[model samples]
Target: MKNSRGSLVRPHPLPESASRPVVTPLSPSVVYASDTPDALDAQYEGRVHGYTYSREGHPNADVVAARLDGMEGVAGGVVTGSGMAAVSAVLLGLLKAGDHVIGGNQLYGRSLRMMKEDLPRLDIATSLADPGDVKAVEAAIRPETKLILVEAVSNPTLRVADIDGLAKLAKDRGILLAVDNTFTTPRAFRPFEHGADIVIHSITKLLAGHSDVMLGWVAAKDPALAQRLRVFSVTAGLTASPFDCWLAERGMLTFDLRFERAQATAAALADHLATLPGVKRVIYPMRADHPDHTRAAALLQGQGCNMVSFELKGGREAANAFTRAAEGLSFAPTLGDVGTTLSHPASSSHRALTPEERAALGLSEGFFRVSVGLEEPKALLAIFAEAVAAAVPGA
Candidate 1:
């Protein structure tokens, strides 16, 4: 290695036979090589073609980023190590000390905690408002407010946000509206179409659709913001691993089919759960009883989310019993798996919140969220029915 410039100087060529196949699956590579000194210099100088380092950029990451951008119809995007990484990159890259951010009260618990606790530590103030109440959200916005953070569909409860309304609110105030569209994958609801300034996704969920990868992405309607995010991602060391990006890209091939099937199952299961005596309430975007039904219908593009939530009359005890009885389904803390899984919010996702805080968000001891999977609907229904009966024999 005897280069004054930053270009990688290989001692010798990679050992290989002269003959090689023309077609091959693209593999994850951390570093690219070139034989010519001038070409290598050009690459190091930012004039030539390939990735010089893994942290800055890679081919696998580029493919995933481009596909995500295409899905959302956004200008550009970047992949990150995790969903929180994506969220943090956008907030830290775009916002600074003294900036004001408006966040939704019904956001994912970790996101809420970050805005409420971490942002204040950095002198970036945040106001939590229910996006469902447009007037309340508008009231909370201040002159210094620069961003509105919300979820396309809230976690655990499946409360769909009025993205179009929030988009208008952000536009009128000249602020950025960032929606975490993890619940409704871009195929189900393109946030850009509804005028969202930024669209974020926890690709670990439905996009991956198999629970094998951990990755996230942020796409921006504004190219400048996307560029900033890319730089921030690299410097912050939050860029997704090349292998994860490659795996997620492969998952995207069947995402449309998986999401369609899963959501249909969710809708059917929601209706069935509503009929169960043990379930006090069922929440799904397609249900008429859901408060956000009309709004979700308008925004969901006729495909409901791959989640169904319900409240059991007997509280946490019954939830535990049901999970024990549900032999075929996984009792996992996470969601968006190909195999259906159940999670208890009171004990898992929203466990950090106080009882009052949980209650305010309509989360109680008996509340459970079911992530519908790509399985036979009848088989899933039978397993759930058996579990409910075992949990509440009389009811």
Candidate 2:
């Protein structure tokens, strides 16, 4: 977040009350570049390294990219216009016509759709598998398998994948391991430290907690691979505006503060919602009742993320009713905003997936996604509880 003027007064909104605020120490003139630099010579322009143009490298974008690389502990990083841009750049850079990609079936709908529909158009073959089923991952890999991609914490349903195990598998098969850390961000998980070759994030989500920016970042352990990503990013013109990068950086600085409260809210709401009527199932990764709680505990040692998804007993109609009844809840398909966001899986984020596809991934019509924010845990819960009570009869 080069040139990011983070909140001078970093407000820590508490569940109970507001605390004394601390301000960030950065104020760069974050202006979008007029010239979209294409060539290396033009992008570098005898700068610190070789950044000649705005498209390839601008001081502002490069500064933010460096911050991301440092945060993720990777060799290099590339920033893009959006998370999908980063995904596309990595795929275009790493995969070729005959290359095989073994992907997780339970992914952000756009991600899955990208592999299923977009990759084939480029003549790349993909094998979708249940990431929760480790055996399927091993079984799906072919000799041509060049990449094994999975979300660190999946969208809609917050299922934690065995990243270290998958990274080892990719190492054994000489395939790249790319983990999408959009939900968890670096505050909760560091994929490279866990043996992943590459880590990608939709900064617009959790990292840019304010939901005002549309940016993406990809960090790689291998410098060679990072260079390839840079090449693809420049060629594809997947450049993030400096203003967006600055805004995203502003959000990143407060990530620790925001998530601390959000995580607590998620936990409290998880417990509260489980007892409420029409809430048949709850999926909070850190909860003891969660099937994958042990692994989540092992991986996310201290920092717990704020995403929680649950099944409403009343199904789609209930889901729609609850969402429509939301007064304080921000009814958006996006997540990780400072404002609490409620997403309906059947019609929102996973709408791109067909009924069969969603069912195979265990995404039912009753599924509701919640991104816990700085809102008071009780207030958010009460908002949802009232919605649930209205959606389902009795209590």
Quantify all predictions' global Cα lDDT against the true fold: 0.87, 0.82
Tell me the spans in candidate 1 whose CA falls farther than 4 Å from its real position: 1-28, 34-46
Model 1 lDDT, full chain set: 0.87
Q: What TM-score against the true fold does each predicted structure earn?
A: 0.92, 0.88
lDDT of 2 by residue, 151-184 (tens): 9888877788988788888888798999999888
- Per-residue lDDT for 239-262 in model 1, tens only? 788888878888888888898889
Residue runs of model 2 more than 4 Å from their true location after superposition: 1-51
Poorest lDDT segment (10 consecutive residues) of candidate 1: 21-30
